[model samples]
Target: MAASKTKKQVRKSQFKLTSEQEADLRKVFDIFSKGGEESGYGTISAEDIKIAFRALGYEPKQEEIRQLISGVDKDGKGLLDFNDYLAIMTKKMTQKDDVEDLQKAFELLDRDRDGKINSGDLQSVAAELGYFTGTMAEDLQEMIDFADKDGDGVVSEREFLKFLKKTTFE
Candidate 1:
């Protein structure tokens, strides 16, 4: 029987923290926030994110830091409350189904909706993802060359699907 298009698909459960982990995360959140939640003044700013990244031994660029902050700063208020922090942590912690994740990633990267991803396409996506740099053109070129199985100078949807399947296995 053919599947019913009207049926809503169910996703896997999202990540949840243990009580001890939640406590630890709360402590970290408090440290990053301006004040306690009860005071209605607690929020982790972009600077807080940068400091936390440094503390975790990562030296991200300003754009990357902003992008990371945007993912969790729900209100776009340039800050993240505890709930926002929890949401970001949940997204980062979850291990989703590979095919589904790849599809979503591909759609995000294929901004032009032309059913293919070229060097220009990758460059735009990298810029939005906060990875643009002096060497970004070369990086995108290398990625295209590596993934373009048909040697068409671009990655077609078929090629992308194949690459995703192989990468998932690896």
Candidate 2:
């Protein structure tokens, strides 16, 4: 499936938060919502959105913040309610966690720290994980071939992410 289609499907899907998660998110929202005298009791401004994301361990770019606010601020009043905040946080947290996990996996495979995973990296990682059978060279090469979209004989970070997303979500 196309990345755009996957994104749309993700948006259409309902993301649930546990009661504990909801309470924690609410606490963060409330703290930011009451930051200034002009702040409302249950709404947060765009700046508050940035701070809230940071508090939640995400360092979103300014453009990302603007896009999120534009997408979720239904009234265009430059403020977000708890429901809007929850939606943004839920989606963002999910995406962040997936990307972070993928990144960590990629880093583990890229043992040489060369920013790309060659067959040697894959072989080393497989050996470390005790998965190195005698046919390891061919297996590692096949893995690299599957993920190396550019046919460069290695998997770059972008290719690794795209490959995993395609395989996992499709």
Candidate 1 colliding pairs: none
lDDT by residue (tens digit), candidate 1, 86-150:
66554433423445577777888888998888888888877888988868799789998999999
Q: After superposition, how far is residue 165 of candidate 1 from its true place, in Å?
A: 8.6
Candidate 1 weakest ten by summed lDDT: 5-14
Q: Give the TM-score (vs. native) of candidate 2.
A: 0.65
In model 2, the runs with Cα more than 4 Å from the true position are 1-15, 34-41, 111-115, 123-159, 162-170
| CA RMSD of each candidate after superposition | 14.3, 5.3
lDDT of 2: 0.83
Candidate 2 weakest ten by summed lDDT: 32-41
Number of clashing pairs per prediction, in order: 0, 0
Model 1's TM-score against the true structure: 0.42
Evaluate candidate 2 by giving its C-alpha RMSD to the native, one decimal.
5.3
